[model samples]
Target: MAKLDLKTADVPKTREDARPPDGSAPIPIHSRARFSGWFGYVVLVLFAIISLGPIWIAVKTALSDSGTLFTSASSLLPQHPTLFNFERVIGLVNPADPRLQQTSFGKVDFYLALKNSVAFTLLAVVPQIAFSAMAAYAFARLRFYGRRVIFFLFLAATMIPSVVLFIPNFILIKDLGWLNTYQGMAAPYALMTPFAVFFLRQMFLSTPRELEESALIDGACYFTIFFRIVLPVHRSALATLSMLAAMNAWNDFFWPFLVGRDRSVQVMAVAINSFRAQQAGGTPDWSGLMACTVLGIIPVAVLLIFFGRKVVESLQYTGFR
Candidate 1:
């Protein structure tokens, strides 16, 4: 008699025979086209109205002139729609007289601030994700001394309020002579964040180890495996992290204001503040302020519109893991 390799055995299963070991009936498949109920639809409709009502009001006000916006706050539609506010806030077009209220308010150069925002976001996010993936890979796969202790310290750091580190970061940046520079704005954030490292570590751990072992047998190094194999498999996590990093950098006010006070280097939030500071008299450029707010909102809004579904999938996958 020949000995058999049970490890390599293939077992065939039948649908009717796929019952639970306790012999409970198999779950029945139901049509996904069934209605979720009128109550569910009513709740969703109410949620949509609650979410979109404020945004519609903002858009309406942004399109109207200051005279109309202040007087007709409750108007469902703009009585008069114009790009005067947008052109004013952007500082690209000037009214006939530079002394005019709108033109004076317009001189803030929001376009430059927007450019700086894009550059800083890219510079910070790219290296941040790269470093995070490397750190996460080490934590999830490599066997090293004091790994648990070091990881615990990283987790502990997240518990401390970020506000607590502001003074220390400001002092360190000042000591390094990095104030008012783009490098100063981007450098501090261009490292692995604890949350990012933890999230990616969870993702890396869930990936199959056999793929890495196969690469090792073919004389591939860790870098090759990481770059060619691991990252490609986790693009969902990468996309999700990239979106999160972009959101943080895009909406950031305090840190950017602290380190980048220069006119040429100011981000969107600081630029908007400077624009508002000039409203010393007159009707107040509510339209221009609203337009700037709208401008600040567009990039992230578009990002969510295009990549929202993928990011949601990544979240679900992470939660399931």
Candidate 2:
């Protein structure tokens, strides 16, 4: 035993004192991280400019007076913006030339075409989504004879190009006497999109089966589980499917053009093509064409803006995740 020296003895301090003064906190110095952050922002800005620059030019072109459009000094900022082009494009102008075709613009039925496109989209999209959803649910959850084989067949069918079926589809429509009608335009295109079913089926399958099992234990039928649980949980998938279906139906040109022999049933794409052809009689009205193109893009833009996130999330949930 050592003798106690009480007056000059050292004592152990608390554990807090064991830590360094600047303990795990790191101080960010002026370095590569800051530079990288600034660089990333700059790159983003440049990318945005590159992406949207043409769209801005289109807007400027659409707003400029039709006469001044061909002039060289039409900068990104229009020297003079006028609604005349929009008016002419929308058929608000009544031309004094009767011998010329009666058009909303000087030569195009832009409004009618837009209307037809909207109608076709509306008529086709709802049934497509509903039918696809039901089919997907059955394939995903229901155990039936030949279920796997049938699904395999559907998957195989998706590999076949729509263009290959065009002739037979056309003949069927013609036989049904649905030529140049809205029903004919929408019907053949709307039924049982294999890709849509496949997409939704994957989503439905990814959902935990425990929920469906619980529902079944409670005496809830398959339809009840689908409607109450599956649909609600997979709303994102539905939105994505609906948006894609609508886009396909709306932008469809070749099929509609071939089937819609009459002007009354012609979609916007066909109408736009017809407008381009008619306007280019001797000289192309690039301004009017640009205006029509802008108008045509608006609906799709709106749909994307509203439903794009859902579509992306749904796609992720369905497969990518």
Candidate 3:
């Protein structure tokens, strides 16, 4: 019943014929898409530059020589790039040098601060991760009375500004005689934070129930299931949480400044402040300061660089719900 349109089938459509029947110019969709893609790339590059500029400046300053820094401060690259600044920060600089004696590098005690920072981070991160994971499991898998109400209350606690809690928390810590102690510095953060709890809870909720059920059938306790089944399945998520917690603990300034002012317990952040103060009424050891900052950043930077993919993969599966 069909008549074959052989002539039309053989003929190629011209650009004009490719236009819609109404006969306005066809949209240059491919060109528009290309333009949009280029625009997005430009925006991303711009944001990257903005985000990384300061860090680049810090590195540049750190690499610069102290004597030549003022002369070449405006230059992008260090005029005389040297490791002397780094050596100075680490206290390997020759003390016999007159220039070294004039500065406050002796008072900075960077190694002590570094040790304290590592200690504080460990004390905060280990207990926090352990407690947060257990609490998340309870919220996600176990049934108990007032669970919803208690969980909501925990969520509500996140809405409360941290600054508002500082006074009460400070008074409590002071009353407990935790000032200038590593324990005092770590105590506030050692328990579960709402964000960590909420993060792990979402992950736990997403895990397949079948494995947990099977484990229970084998006469496994909740602890066994959590330790043997759940934790191994979500190791990436736990690593992500640890990295985040480490960064937070390392960079914290105000609280550590309040509670851990003594040199023995001072962290890297407070050490920077003390370094600046020791150089007061004089030209700051700009190179040394920047070097110290770079050293402080290296550990976390190395962690992120190595475990960055795990962090991204874990975050990819995280649901807003």
Model 2 per-residue lDDT at 312? 61
Best by the lDDT measure: 3
Model 2, residue 250: C-alpha shift (Å): 2.1
Cα lDDT tens digits, model 2, 227-293, are: 9999999997687778777767887888899898577878989987877777454767767877888
Could you tally the backbone clashes for each prediction?
A: 0, 1, 0
In candidate 2, the residue pairs with backbone N, CA or C atoms under 3 Å apart (3 or more residues apart, or in different chains) clash, namely 91-104
lDDT score, residue 108, model 2?
Answer: 73
lDDT of each: 0.77, 0.76, 0.83
- Per-model TM-score, in order, reads 0.81, 0.79, 0.83
On residues 20-98, what C-alpha lDDT tens digit does candidate 3 reach at each position? 6798886443444445556666777989999888888899999987777779878989887998888877877677878
lDDT of 1 at 255: 86
- Candidate 1 lDDT tens digits, 1-321: 012221212221344544557878864422221222334556679899999887777777788866676578878888778776777667656556443544335456778999988888888888999999999999998889999999999999988777788789988999999998888888877997787899899989988899998999999999999999889989977878877777677778888988888889998898888777767465446677778888887875786798787766654533210
Query: What local lDDT score does residue 226 receive in model 3, on the 0 to 100 scale?
Result: 94
User: How well does model 2 score by local distance difference test?
Assistant: 0.76
* lDDT minimum window of 10 residues, candidate 1: 1-10
